[model samples]
Target: MAPTNNHRTRCGDTRFPRNVILLLVTIFVFLMAAISIAWLVMHPHDPGFAVTSLSVTNFSLSDSQVRGRYEVGLTITNPNKIITQVVLHRQGSLLLYDSELYSKAAVQTTVNLEKLTNKSVKVDFEVKDQHQKVVPPILGRDLNKGVVNFNVVLKVTVRFEAGIWPSKDELLDVTCKDLDLEFHPKTKGTGNLLGIGKNCSTKNAAGRT
Candidate 1:
């Protein structure tokens, strides 16, 4: 009779049913969490896009002897996800740091619409500085008191996929007065260059019609 009573008490334990239900619910929640985690790991976003890398480097000018082969280099990076149909087409104008010679080089940027994870690329630019025969009144005179700047200009066009990355026509204000008079001759070249004053120049528009 004592054993029988013990068995009945064990079977009637009210906490037993509650504990079993709680365990089942806990297991279901864990299973759901695991499945959700698996989905996130295996599936990518709709576009699967991310900015893995961003930088500007490898800028080189020609050997200074080549006539029109003024070579410039650039690089772009992408990592992880895939960027498809990538291309680069940069467009912009070069400017002088001063107001003397309108020496123009080329303002440019790199474009990559498609890239794979952890990838590096190089770009070669042929920065052309068109020489104008016309001479400026202050050809060699220091136009900016003691400030040095670029004396040339170049228009660049960088196109990637359906977007265009452009820069405000660079107002490259480079000072050259610190250089020795014998080495750095003070002479401004010819060209309609944009000056960096309170006003705006034609080269300041990132996207000009």
Candidate 2:
């Protein structure tokens, strides 16, 4: 049978029919999608993951004296990818409500916080407000029992070579930041021990009035 013009045109590699071209485009798109999926599945990141969460434990007054030492508990963990070596630096400065009392310190710690894991670390800070400084008479009592305001903040830097990189937040409102300072009598309300019973009046005294 003599070859039809349609067959000759097709065999000659002329412009493809619109429908045929559309079909080819669809197949190519599907193939590209498949390749992408395969690549993604095969090329998983070498470093497993980054930090899932970070937190500080608690800051409590270990002693009553403003010059007394204070300890802060903090934890930094890597919950995701594998990290080779993580070195964290934390610095804190505290301003006591009383100018006489204040503290400041800098600290650095290194850990091998593995991927998909958590590590517990403790940060200890001591505040000594008893530096040689004259106090104004109206400023109130000695540095020992005065009302003191204090805050400590911490910043963490993480380096991840094996897995994913992580970023940490600076702890605010916490004693670790060294931002804490005494709020002064105006804001501290009643005084510490001395002011406790000053307002107390016997029920009898109240009845007489």
Candidate 3:
């Protein structure tokens, strides 16, 4: 008699078990939910940045060059309960008549903020060794009007610390508009600027990193 052969076929061998598949799906849902909750809880309100004063020293324009020394005072207000670190770096410019008059020359000092605290910072800006090309337009203008209009643009990095997790830093675009100044012979072309009160706006909604 010839030997008999038996063959067995397996069904659905490559498919996952129903229980295992359910477990994986449940885990994915839970992870997504957690991330959503974290974001909602960590969302922060806009902080306050105001220019308290702007002082100028040795503001002069000659036939060859334009020179000026300036100091800008800013007050930072943190409204959140978490600690924050605000960094105003040197990456922007000062504009006069849409002209690039001065560049950011130094990094602003780092600020360590406590919860709901106010911090004051001063930025010193000076323009020297510049060409005379930007002077003719301003010199011919009436300085006796007692006001020169300027605009300042800056980029700041803000970091927040909450509980044990420090949120990723946020880059903010700060623009100070319509900084008007009057030159006085008392300071010999040096005086405090006007219209700098609460004239700054910060935009960070582009994206957070």
- lDDT scores of the candidates, listed in order: 0.31, 0.41, 0.72
Question: Candidate 2 residues 52-116, lDDT tens each?
Answer: 22222122232343444444444454544444444444554444444434444446766676666
lDDT of 1 by residue, 1-209 (tens): 35797788887797799899999999999977876675455332111112211112221223221122122222233332433232323432223323232222343333443534322333233434445333233423443343323322223322212122111112222121211111122332211112321111122244322
Q: What's the residue-level lDDT of 179 in candidate 1?
A: 17
Model 3, runs deviating above 4 Å: 1-36, 62-66, 128-140, 205-209
**Candidate 2 segments exceeding 4 Å error:** 1-66, 84-86, 95-107, 128-150, 163-209
Worst 10 residues of 2 by lDDT: 196-205
Order candidates by TM-score, high to low.
3, 2, 1
> Which one is best on TM-score?
3
What is the overall TM-score of model 1 with all chains considered together? 0.24
**lDDT of model 2, residue 154:** 37
Steric overlap count per candidate? 34, 24, 0
Candidate 1 whole-model C-alpha lDDT, 0 to 1: 0.31
